[model samples]
Target chain A: MNIKELHRQYKKRLAKEKRWIRFYQLLLLIGFFVLWETASSNRWIDPLIFSSPSRIFRLLMDMISDGTIFIHINYTLFETVLGFILGTLIGTILAAILWWFPTLSKILDPYLVVLNSMPKVALGPILIVALGPGMTSIITMGAIISVIISTIVIYTSFRNVDANYLKVLQTFNATKWQMFKEAILPASFPTIISTLKVNVGLSWVGVIVGEFLVSSQGLGYLIIYGFQVFNFNLVLMSLLIIAVFATLMYQLVEMLEKRLIKNE
Target chain B: MGFLIVENVSHTYFSKDAATEALQDISLTVEEGEFISFIGPSGCGKTTLLSIIAGLIRPTAGNVYIENQKVYGNKDLSIGYMLQQDYLFPWKTIEENITLGLRLLKQDVDRGIASKLLKDVGLPAVEKKYPRELSGGMRQRVALARTLAVDPKILLLDEPFSALDYQSKLKLEDLVFKMLKQYNKTAILVTHDIGEAIAMSDRIILFSPRPGRIHEIFEISEDIRRLTPFQARSHAGYSPLFQQIWKELERLEH
Candidate 1:
């Protein structure tokens, strides 16, 4: 075959492979729900704890009809997004500060290690006491969870940029600030985007745990309240909703990554 | 007095365990628009001397003067430096990279300048493309354009063509030589290649290693100097001069 015909065949094969992979993904998701429903209804698993997909879907319908699901989802989504933005922004700024002052980074190195190692969720109670048991405390919890790790990772990337790039700028008699702006920050973009992807998951964990502690409102509260009342369907419903939103947020970050790093 | 002067310059790099002298008592002078090359063995501190001359690094004891003024920490004098590798910012487009020095200096970035430099470097239509999109030689050409865009008073090229394949290296040497002559720009090249030094420079300074000092200087004959680098390489005097430098370099290495 000619090159054009061969290229056409290659594209066709790639499309077929993609279709099969997507088909399997869909099949797996459906098979999981079907098996869980069958097991619960057949009493192969304890229906009370296992809580079939149909039961969860019926519970979801009830919550949707009552319009109560949106409230919890909205609260969780807003807190997670704000917390994620604040965490990434604050961490990047902190990293820039550390980059600007090497002496400060050296001084804070041990403390950063300590703070990063300690369970940030464990600080929920203290945050609740200090910031009060409200959205403020919960958002702070989310922000705090990812900030230290982001600072450390981004700072490492900043430091690791090729020194030659700085040398080029220095030849032009560039100021320190210009070096950071033109070379260091832009060079560290790929790292920053990857850190954003990690922070998405981290912020969710923090917000959920904070809600569990606050015991006020959100998907985490729903899960906690469901466990107390023995409502397995409610817990399952909240879990499924969280999964969908988290994946959506991750996909959004992926989209942003593609846009920002178009040159590479 | 020459256009650029290095007077009794020496440098020592310090670490916790030891302080190593990298360059010692290096003094040289280049007349205006003179093309000079420093050829030497590795660790000869040719690059260190170039950095010192560019005021990127301070000499341990001595001074570099450009047009009767100290070069160290002097911002008014523009010095263009090109490295072994292209080192173009991957995120920046060719246009942005070329205008970077002007922007850094807070000068009004003239759009015409980028296009003009690109044309001069024979890379006219690649302004919007990133550095990664170009070939190695092409990227290096873009780097040259970027360096020249600021209209530096002196250019310090640290093994700029060493990374290229032979054909591209020869071609770039010709291009750089022609452009420097066309603009009447003063330039200093550091090279490990004796032939390249002879082909491109008016005067070649061969350096000795181990506390790095100048060993010898060779001046090109007037007949050989009139031609482009590629033509100069094919001239009768080229091989003899190359042989002499090669023998000097061999002796230094041993």
Candidate 2:
């Protein structure tokens, strides 16, 4: 009936349209990869900057045979997963603790802003100096970097919860913990899930940076190594691996959100 | 003490600069099963009075008692309050929302009774449905069910049907009235609509705005509140009675 409502209706229908488009896109992707194999066989395009998809696929085979690909992938995933979990947990707990006390929230607010502004890579050197170069330094610093964003996002959403709902809870004489359990958590769930989606990207940034900084083995190190040797295939392969892992994590967060979040 | 008593109950809202009185020297009593309405113009503190009685607020000075028990500075689980908003938890199914009070109690309840209450509320099929999936009236029904599930001795209603369309409002008022009667609980309704008060209450407490105080009172017999608001609108003496009430409310506002 109204312009906004009409737009909402159109947008609601857009998902179904996109689903079909995505299926076609999948076909196009498979064709592009096949076409790469075909073009390289025919010697049509230079497989330098634009490495042949077939060659990349063969690299995948070689990496698997040598077991180096699994090692790097596992290391990257280990760092990313560890960082993601630790970041979310520490960020949420710290934000909640700080949010409870306005004075502390104010005091630490700028520090978090400063911490968030600091490039995660800078933390890499400090963490290595303190915790030493290994998975611990990488994961801890990465967690620290990504967790701050989640802390800010989830805290803003948690803080933005409706005053009226809080009033209702107050009328119930709900304990602070009860208020958090019943109203705060559920109300902030959508925002928290969205923050998780955002932090998934940040977590990957941390892991890749961590790997590039001091890791013995990881997708990030592999990328750096490929770049050093001027091996375009290895670089592309590592980038693709990171992309796949990040996409999987993003999808997992999305699925969890869809399952848990109410329409509200 | 009456089943509920408000003795010189007054409320003043304090801002940084000054204080504004919302209610002044208000007093009323409701028997155990009486249905009363506080009716007046907007900003007349009708809702404020009901909120006070519900223990949602404490008067600046004065006291309220429930069954001879001093209420201020005490948490009240003995009352059921339904506000203008349905206030149903959107993420929860109807059954979950309805049983919220019981869940908060952290006690074991008879499933048989809960189901029976759902049937009594005329919403047995709603248990599985989420709040957004229901019509506005149905959502309020669940709210009512939730309030009643606590089995409070009294119920406070704050213009709970103001958001509904006329037809739906009449239907819900009739349904709620019948359900309240069956429960045989005392009720205090806050409404700006005089006709609604007259149709649904045994007595009306009118208040003047700008420091709301009791201005007038009306006594209705058993006959009127039994009819639907629409049906009561067409009742014999409805027009002249509402005209007088409308004039009185307007006089208070200006």
Candidate 3:
């Protein structure tokens, strides 16, 4: 065949391969479910000790029938959203201030490192005491990890902006504020959006951990209650719900990233 | 007073690890509407000298003056600088990048001026496109238009065509020469290309490396300036002049 005909054949084969890969992905998922159901029914694994996907689905149906799962999901979603917003806002402001004030940044750098390394769960008892057994403590817990991580990530990316672009403005005698607005912020925007994507996962982790510690009504609390009462199916169901919700939140961030970097 | 004067300017770059002397006791005077090229090896502080004149750097000793005023930390003169890379802000579209200096100065951005400059540089229809969308040559044209947008009295070009392919570089060189002539702007270009220096300059200032100081100065006759760079390449004295500059550069390397 001529080059053009060969090129067409290559493209056709590549498209076929992609379809096969996607087909196998679905097949693998279905096959795992079938194997799991078979094992549970045949008693190869005791369904009581090792709950199957069907058991988890049944628990989900019961929760839906009673309308309690919605409350749990709504509570967790509200906490995560609130924490995400607060963390992003606080982190961005702190990063700007740190960038503006080098001396303050120097003084606080080591402390930030220590705080990031510390197990945030250890602060649960103190947060409960300070904010009481309420949404405030849970939101505070959720915001803690994201706040420091976002601040550091954003500040570093801000500093890493191309120095030559800054010089282009400097030669024109642009002010510090102009340099930040025109060059630094716009140049670091893609990184900021990526940080937002990461923050979705981080904020979700924070909310769930917070719920684990103090909440009476979130997915984390359901898991805790199920474990206490030896109801493995409820625990599995809550976990699956959390997974689906986290994926949805992540997809939202991905959509935002696509919009922000559209030009790129 | 000369149009622009560098009075015994010297510069030293100091760091905690080491102090490096970049330029030493350099003095020159540029007349109004003259094009001068500084030719030297890398690390010879050609860019440092241009920055000093642009008031981006303060020399260790002595001063640069434009129309009898010291140039250090001065912004009223409006020096337009173009670097090796285009340095166009990627986020901004072509027109916005071109009008950046005007924006910074808080002057009303006249779209007419930007359009005229883009036409002059042969990039007329690309105002809405981002910098990344254009070729390297096209981006440099946009950069040139950007520099001209501010209506600077003096232009500093630091190897502006060094990154381009030969054909684009030649085209840009002619375009730049024509634009500078039309605007009647005083320009100082820093380049390692001796042939380019000889083609585009009224005078070529040769410098020695490592504590760079003027090694020699050659003044090209008015006859050469009357022709375009392409036409000037075939001028009678072109080969002799090119050979002389090539020898001088080779001598400096040893």
Name the 10 consecutive residues with the lowest summed lDDT in model 1 chain A: A209-218
Best by DockQ: 1
lDDT of 2 by residue, A77-122 (tens): 9888888888988878877887688798988988988887877677
Between candidates 1 and 2, the DockQ winner:
1
Full-model lDDT, candidate 2: 0.81
lDDT of 1 by residue, B90-209 (tens): 888999998998998778888688888888888758888888989999999999998998889999999999999999999999999999999999999999888888889999999999
Weakest 10 consecutive residues, lDDT, candidate 2 chain B? B70-79
CA RMSD per model (angstroms): 1.1, 5.1, 2.1
| Best of the two (2, 3) by DockQ | 3
Q: Pick by TM-score: which candidate is best?
A: 1
Candidate 2 segments whose C-alpha is farther than 4 A from its true place: A1-55, A164-173, A262-264, B16-18, B221-231
For every candidate, how close is chain A to the native chain A in TM-score?
0.98, 0.85, 0.92
DockQ category of candidate 1: high
Residues B3-120, model 2: lDDT tens digits: 8888998789999999989999988888988889888877878877877776767779788888988765565556788878888777777777777777665646667655677787
- Model 1, position B43, has a per-residue lDDT of 94
Residue-level lDDT tens digits of model 3 in A1-264: 899999999999999999999999999989998998899999999888678998888888888999999999999999998888888879888888888888999999999899878887678889989999889998988787688888998899888987889888987779889998999888888877887878888888888878888889999899888889988888888888888888998898888878777668
